[model samples]
Target: MTKIADFRAMTPDQLSDELLKLKKEQFNLRFQAATGQLEKTHRVGEVRKDIARLQTLLRTKQPAA
Candidate 1:
């Protein structure tokens, strides 16, 4: 998992790709939880937080037209 500061340095396209990857991971985590296969439930929260952090960084880095 990448840090928020490192995420902030990424370009918008890169950030979007990262967000997509994180979302996919989150979905898998949810599935694992439903199947009782999740060994690390805390990872779900971490992925959610990372998603939010990436979004915030994307918004903050957007240039004013």
Candidate 2:
């Protein structure tokens, strides 16, 4: 799980990379759940929140229009 400060410390490129990784993880988790193979179901919520946090940070980092 990434802390908010960690997200803040990242370059935009790194944040994007992490986001992609998390999204892939999220997909796998869902696949596992659909197959009735999911363990640590808590991970789903954690990933969802992390994705939200990362996206929020990304939005803030965007250049002004």
Pairs that clash in candidate 2:
none
Off by over 4 Å in 1: none
The parts of candidate 2 lying over 4 Å away from their true place are: none
- Index of the highest-lDDT prediction: 2
Candidate 2 residue 47 Cα shift, in angstroms, is 0.3
Q: Candidate 1 local accuracy as lDDT?
A: 0.91
**Using Cα atoms with residue i matched to residue i, what is each candidate's TM-score against the true structure?**
0.89, 0.96
Q: After superposition on all CA atoms, what RMSD does each candidate show versus the true structure?
A: 1.3, 0.6
Residue by residue across 1-65, what tens digits does model 1's lDDT show?
56767987789999999999999999999999999999998899999999999988888878976
